[model samples]
Target chain A: MTAWLLPFLVPFIVMNAILGIVTYVTLLERKFAARMQSRIGPYRVGPHGLLQPIADAIKLMMKEDVVPTAADRPIYNLAPIVFVLPCMFIFATIPFAPGLGVADLNIGILFFLAVSAMEIVGLFMAGWGSNNKYAMLSAMRAVNQVISYDLPFIFSALTPVLLAGSLKLSDIAAAQAGLWFIFYPVIGQLAFIAFIVSTVASENRAPFDILEAESELVAGFRVEYSGMKFALIQLGEYAHVIGASFLGALLFLGAWAGPGPEWLGPVWFLITAMLIFLLVTWVRWSFVRIRVDQILALSWKALLPSTLLLLIATAIVVVWRGVPGV
Target chain B: MTIAAPRHVELDYTGSERLTMNMGPQHPSAHGVFRAILQLEGETVVGVDAVIGYLHRCHEKLAETLTYAQYPSIASKTDYVAAMTSEFAYVRAAEMIGKIEVPKRAQYLRVIAAELQRVASHLLWLGTWCLDMGGALGGGATIFLYCIREREMILDLFESLVGARLLYGFYQVGGVRYDLPAGWVDTCRQTVDVIDTRIDEYQRMLEDNPFFQVRTQGVGVISRELAQEVGIAGPLLRGSGVAFDIRRGEPYSSYEDFEFRVPVETSGDCFGRYKVRMAEFRESLTIVRQALDRLPDGPISSRPGLKSVAQTRIPKGEAYARVEGARGEVGCYLIADGSAKPYRMKWRGASFSNLAILPHIIPGHKVADVVAIMGSVDPVFGEVDR
Candidate 1:
């Protein structure tokens, strides 16, 4: 009876924990961005705005759910749930520590990459169902940009898999015990840089954030969404960012491998993930966004070819050194 | 206010459908209450129709009702970003037409106020232009906040000198309204010095940055011939290698006495205009420092203090006084009828003329370039609509 309930209970706990963390991650970003701009962010709420996210959550929940008269109601209502699910689903495969995860699938990194890419469908659905021109234009850009970057993102992620010689994420982490992939010679550094660039592009942050270019598209695909619908869309976006950060930590930084006892493994893993998240956030706030064409050009002309070369080189190095686990 | 009907134009090209998109009057990067109806072939803009007058407040008609004494304060409303320059043009017109002799001391005071106003206004333009290109939540906000921080110091200087920050009624027909308060010069000197160093910081932040360079460079190209033909003034003109500044050419309000270089860039693009403005920031500071050093002791106004609304009357004559405002050449044409109020007053708002060049240059660029071009143009709606 206890074994039967284990799978169900673990997922239920993880979902609730993610929902709570996603809300607070927003506050963390705001504070981080605020310091960069030399201003105090959210100071008026309960004790340095610790309760600000809670207040915001309550407000969003209590607010009216405004559906546009011209909207396709069913798709509009279903889009947020569809979008948030895949983002949260990616976390299930990301092991926080040894023996600590949801499924730990055999093809863990592949599953993570494939499932993470599914958020675009819900993004397009929200944009199409809104019945607004800005939303439609933004959705078009989103499709173009995300598809272009995914190749580079995948090729770069595969570099580490090539280095570790394993499809399983736990095996990849275990192989990093002797030396992290990021600390490996030439191929590792190049792949990590490529990974970060594609991650930023896929996440739709600045310098590549033409889809939601507020100066151009206002709120972009989510322009017509209001109340809790807007909150869910926002939650999904942060969850995706957090999910990517966790994956970056696992693949390159050696997830749960740190200077401490075994019990402190999860704590160190969280720290590494947060560090990766902050690095991406730093890039987001330090550059102006490029045009859609320019963004596409960067992905296809630059990132794609270089990442493919890097992937080929990684495979060569792995074969030359004798594959790690195999 | 009713929006004007969208203009229909014939497209020369066939195949792809043209999407007519309305940007602004309500858009985030509109800069003010400006609307542009853009006809696009995919992401490239093929044609543009600009709409103004949402901020129109009958400024010309109001000038007919108020006397010269009462009108200077209201003149500040025209280009509220550089209110001192706006007031200077109105009062200078009154002083010119009436042949009222302004003291040397008063002339120097006007120069100081105008130059300082130039610095303050450019800081605002720099901040908002970055905000327009960068988006409110991104790197643009970082620059915006830093620029505003420096601008606030200048506003504080104005507050101490004239008892107001923005829309100062500091200028009168003969000269300035208030003499520099005790220790105000020291404060002014300190402020400009601090701003001088901060300007370098801003340059370092954006000058070599590839992201900023791509957004601004070669985005908006206004040829020297087009700039002259369209009647655009100030940095927009100088940026195209015109080098025609009213301050240097006409030399009003003792601007001839100040030693400063009028920056000119022949690149004829958004980057050129940006370089011109950044250089102007330094030149304006130089003039401020010079004016502060040579400030003479005397009564501020040539005319006696205002005892009544109609006490100071202008003789029946016509004169157009133009000053180098923060945006461009701010000119006021006054036809006095030997009465307290003018028979006719016409304002040549710099932004009004500066904005006319948009439809000429905005075509064939992508949608992102529109905001970048508009930001480089830097039209304050108060001046444009008035």
Candidate 2:
């Protein structure tokens, strides 16, 4: 029985752990938003809204599933699955502790970026398949906004690689043990800043959340969505945000590199990821969304150029002070 | 108000298809049941067609059926946000027709109430308008909730006096119905002070946010000429550099006794409007403080006699009384036929005119700016549809 269950054990454990964290992250966002707005968030479900996510999950599950009659049934059915699975797959490459992840791919950084980008296809499928004008408009916006920021996001991620001389996340994290790439030099700080900005834009968060802007598009691509399908899409979004946050911690903040016993490595990693998530929430609650054109211009005109300069500078620095790993 | 919308001109399209997006009879930032058919060429609003009268209650017709003294109740309901200003306008018009002399202390009380109402209305606008702009402008609902929380204090002050909170038809033909409750002035003073301090916190949070600036600055610009042509009143007009405040320009309700600036801005944009309203809050606090300070000691109301609301005979005459409401000028025109009821009544609300500039300015801006600009105009649907 031990031999038979061994192969699925790590995947089962990590999947459940991620799902549990993502469920509570939504609660965290709501509570944080409520505090920012000067109101009690969700206090009725459990002590400090602890059981609110569970209640929400059940409510969503029980709700009658709805699909727009005009929608492409197959793609409409498939979109959330497409959106959610790839987001979950991103965790496969993320090394939580010394040996505490689902799988340790050699090309983890590349795989993470590639898998994360797959989220757009699902977003587009949902947008197009829904047969809604607002959804179509949202799809157009998500395409423009997400694709534009992808350049800077990828370019900025290369900065840590430049400093570490490795593409593997664990190797990259181990390299950050001495000093996280965020503090390496002038270019390192700028890259970190760029990466954070890109992450916010990439995840379709506020100050860049023109897609689901309630006042404008009125729920955007998720306009026609209801019940469990809606929940899945939301899950996919929060999952992506937290997943990217974890990747960010691993790349820049020295994953699990805090003090205490080596066995407490996973706890340290969780704390850092959570801190990053809190920072992201702080930004989301504090800023208003810019226009679609403004978002695109900011990425292409501002962030892309700065990140490219940082990349070139990092390359120059890497050669000037030749490290043996490359 | 009959808005003369520009003729819809089909743009010479090079290739792309034009999409007409229906944004609310139920949309979040519509204020009320206002629908705008937006013709968009990639988010730029080429043309906008407004659908109105969604919340029509036939207030003018309803006023005709009500008695002269009882009409203040209807007036209060018309401009729901700043009910005191509307109530004051109707009461003043009746007082003028009947030649009812208001007591000195009662006049001061009216001034104080009107100013407090303005503060309440403006606070609500500040919150909802910031909410309309979403998080990019004023950090979204933080400002909104804070504004509401403070506005509730002003409501509490009203509730203590009038026995009702929002729609208090507290004014009478001769003067105000109730005198100041014991220590009410001090409570009011403290409330305004709290609100004044809270306004500074909003300024720090939103007024200094660079992203907020980008979203608002130079976005929904209504030129001075266009504003005058549209006859937009209050902040919407004043934001375009027009100095036509009924309070300062043509003083009424002993407005000349107390001093306050009619805050104006030249840009005539969303940011300009926002700045004007922010400045107006401080100005309102000044007016409230001044009125309370100079509140003369006298008969809290007129001597119980001929000028009683229900029994008072309205003479055969026509009188129009206008006051600078929180939105703008709220004018009440009453023509009494020597009967208990008015012959014909016309309530001219500022929001009706303010809503007209929407189509003119909306053509060049994005769909999102529609919410921001509409919010900046601050049209209370009750006032507009009435």
Candidate 3:
């Protein structure tokens, strides 16, 4: 039994690292915004607000979780669990560090994509189950917007997979030893930009946050959610954001690959992950949000054509590189 | 009031597949207790029936009970955002009916106060509209804070002149309640001058921004013909390239004396309205600057003593006085009825005119366009549903 426990302990350590990273990601987002807007954020909780997320968690748990009387009892009760479960499941597949990720499956990219798509279902359930009109409207928009934008997102993501000649994320990371895709002059850089736009759109970030336009829909889908349920939903969204950055890093920026001793793969992976999260946070605060139709237009007309071209370009590159072997 | 049957307009109305959604009465973003019953054919709006009267405090009915002297206090509720303009229009209506002569100084003071109020109202609208467009991530709350900062300064000037902040009961039947406070003109002039410089910052933040432009440009288009038929006024009308500003066309309260241009936009969309308002902000500051430069020196009140005027009450007559409010043309129709109180006070709130255009323009657009349309129209339910 003791011999069997050693292998299982690895997953536990990796899981704890993910949880700690996500907690600190929230702290980093706040700190970045505060610096951008010229204010100090969350300095009083602990040394540089290291304990802020803990204090928030405690506060959320202590607050009254009021379920509206008119809400659908079963679905409303289940929505937060549904939202949080996918984020947890996603963590199981994402390659955090070399030999550190729980499952380094051959079809890692496909699995990640499949699991990530489940977030829409959770959002739909939460929105519809709230029994609120605004929530239902947001849910409807969310389904349409997410479904429409997914085409370009998936197509753009296909480019790197084609170039690397494998669906495994670890293999893709290893392929980018010399140069990340973003550094590849025009074609690769365009594909990378498309990935960023689609990733941000899919995660329901600003410019694609129609589901939660506070001034327009009055908190939109989450208007009825409160207390611990609301906190969990927010945590789930932050997790999605972190996951998106990871996806971007994996596909375009060359995940976990940095110059150092070969043994320092895991440490570099952690540092790279933190850098990606900060990049996303900076993007969120720096601009005004775009509307739904604009996003749709961008996805359908702009992103679709550009990504298709990039994918074709990558295919040609692969064939060119392979023909010399004969 | 005849109820018209629903129009048989051939729209993209797929009846069976559509989902009917109800928004508001409880929703915070509806802007002061309003509701819209929308029939959506998949995210595209097919039919929309606006239901108001939720915030209907029966202001007209409430006004019947209040005496003419007490009316100034209640008039502020009509358009709460720019309460000073409401006070000016109502008191001017009373004076028109009573056949009293206003002092030159009082008239000038009224113009200054009303113009300042317009700037304040426009500032609030610009801030909130950006928030509505940008959501939380666009630094919306920061714009809200900056707008309120300028508005607070204007309100302080109102307080110095009229002795109250939100509801200034300063306008009397014949003239104003008091003269301008010493050094008040300089403070107001300085505030206006400083605000003129900061207006560019707001434009840079929202106007030239690609995100803001993309979200607004070519969305929520209202044709010129439709605008006229629907009686859309102010920025909404002007956005469609119509030159129909009441201030310019029918100059009220020394407005003829000022040289200013009414900004117009060719595109009748959300972006057009936004551009017109941004230009109008600069125009409003221009008007305030002009008023302060030529501010006359004399009695600010037509009625010298309140007790002396109380002996000779307003005569039996009726009159209508209209003013260019922050939203559009705000009119007050008053009947004296030979008493201290008005017999009937009918208000033509700018929000009422602005809201009438929604039903005409709402069709053939997605549900998301509703917010853009509503924000462009700039209806305050405190006035619209009042």
Candidate 4:
């Protein structure tokens, strides 16, 4: 039991830290967007709105958790937790710094991908359990969109795996020590673009956010959720975004392998990780959401074909270059 | 062996339970507090039933209690987005029934003011429609803010002419209550010139955007025949290839003197309606420029009299008059029993009749198309439920 405790305790600590960062990410997202729009955001709180999230948390905590009498109680109660837990689980394999990861398992990449898929199930539960037609409709869209886009997403992810010759995330990182995959220049460029597109869709962010289009669906699947439960769902979303960004930086941009010795390696990795997250957020704030069919069309008609070609090209490059021993 | 089996069997018309969804009298996109009960199959809308009267302020009943002089102020709230058109139509109706002829100079100023207000109102619709389509971060709001900046200039011109900004009761039974201030015409010309430049820029950013086009085109198609059947009017009617602009047909105020064409589109889809509204703004600009060019010099009001002018009492009769409002033909039916107040006042709100077609239009569209249809119709709830 004590032996098992160490492994369990490591994930608990790592997931919580990621969760805290995600909360601040939400606040920063608003602040960055406000500055872009030429308005001050949440400034009346403690010192440049550092305490705004604290206030929000307290408010959410105190509000009555009203369960709709018409709702499916068991699923309603389970939805937010399910939505949040997979996001938390996704953090385990994200290599934050050198030797700082929670899991260095051989199939760490697959572990993250499979766990993220649970977000669909969780969102479905929220929508179906709410007993609202809007919720149900939104849920159906969420499932359909996620499934449709997931194919290209997973296919594009294969490019880096082929190049690295291992599904283990740390090994993939070490493989990119000589040259980052994005440095594969043009075709490598195509794969990176494909990866970013898929990841954003997978996380359910803007430009592919048709599932929860507020004007069209009225809060979408989260329409019936209130108070802390709603906040938990939001926290899960931000966590997924941050987690995905870190993994993207790891896979394509080279994780934690910066200019320095091993001890100072983790700090540079954290900065790179932050920089990647900022880049993703900038894209989120700058673009309008595309239509559902456009996103689906992009996946099947454009990205899928491009990803297939890139995978084959990367495999050719890997075989031609004579593989290395890490 | 008399007859072969029927080639096609009719779909079973029976009691399959239809899912009913209530889209509110208080829902965000119903354009105010207007309720629509949508009967759906899965996500497809089978039928829609609208229940209005939620915003019914009983304006007609309120008009019965107010005098002709007091009536224009009350009517301002009916289509509150473009109050000038509402006030103008009511006063025109009263003047028509009362047998008072407004001066020619004031008529040009009225045309100028009303045309400017129409542009401002249409610009507002453009902003809201884009915002509805693009949302906050999509750069959708960039166009909205830009439009408001131009509209503010027009509103400033209104302030210069009338003292108030939004609900200006400048139109009187005889002519107008106020005269144009010094340098007002030149200032307006300069403002309109700047607006003309800005409008071109906005078109470059938004009008040609393929995403914007795909979102709008053929989404909410209202056939010309169906539009006539449903009693749809205004830009919505004109979009269906109707050449029935009240300004062209009846030639109210100084509209007959203006050389502007009534903008029309043949498709009658949401995109066609959007294009019509966009062209109408340019036509209004032409009308404004013409009115400025040919604005004659004279008194703003006529002489006061007991029956015709002074006493503000209409002759015992009835009259129906309409002016092409920003939304459509805003007409008023005034019944005068030789009283200070009208015997009966009924407004033919263009916004109201235009909104009635939504139940017929939105049944086959996706939920997103529902927003597009409501936006293209551009119903002001204050008018619809009045």
Candidates, DockQ:
0.75, 0.55, 0.45, 0.36
**Local accuracy of candidate 2 as per-residue lDDT tens digits, B141-236:** 677888899999999999998989989978877787788889998999999899999999988988788778888999878888788777888888
TM-score (0 to 1) of chain B, per candidate? 0.96, 0.94, 0.93, 0.92
Candidate 4 lDDT, A1-326, residue by residue in tens: 59979888888888667767787777787787666545577887899999888888889988889999999999998999999999888878876665677877789989988888888999999999999888888898898788877777777777788878889888888898898877865756888788888888877776566667765667789989999999999888888888787777887778777776877766666676677777776666544456666667777788778888888887888798855415
lDDT of 2 at B22: 91
lDDT of 4 by residue, B134-220 (tens): 554444555666677788898899888888888888787888878889999899999878888877877776667666777788887
Interface RMSD of each: 1.0, 3.0, 2.6, 3.0
> How do the residues B64-136 of candidate 3 rate in per-residue lDDT, one tens digit apiece?
7777777877888888988877887888788888878988777877888888888989888876776666665
What order do you get sorting by DockQ, best first? Answer: 1, 2, 3, 4
Better of 2 and 3 by DockQ: 2
Query: How would you encode candidate 1's per-residue C-alpha lDDT over A1-326 as one tens digit per residue?
Result: 69999989999988888888888888888899999988889878799898999999999999998899999999999998898889899998988789888989989999999999999998999999999888888898989999999999999999989988888999999889988889888887898899999999998888788878888888889999989999989888999999999899999998899997998988888889889999998888777778787888889999999999888888888888887644
**lDDT (Cα, tens digit) per residue for candidate 2, span A50-155:** 9999999999999999889999989888998999988999999899997778778878889988888888888888889999988888988988988998889999
C-alpha displacement of B155 in model 4, angstroms? 4.4
Give candidates' CA RMSD values in order. 2.9, 2.2, 3.7, 5.0
Proportion of the native interface contacts kept in model 2 = 0.53
Ten contiguous residues with the weakest lDDT in model 3 chain B: B1-10
Range of the 10 consecutive residues with the lowest summed lDDT in candidate 2 chain A: A317-326
Best by lDDT: 1
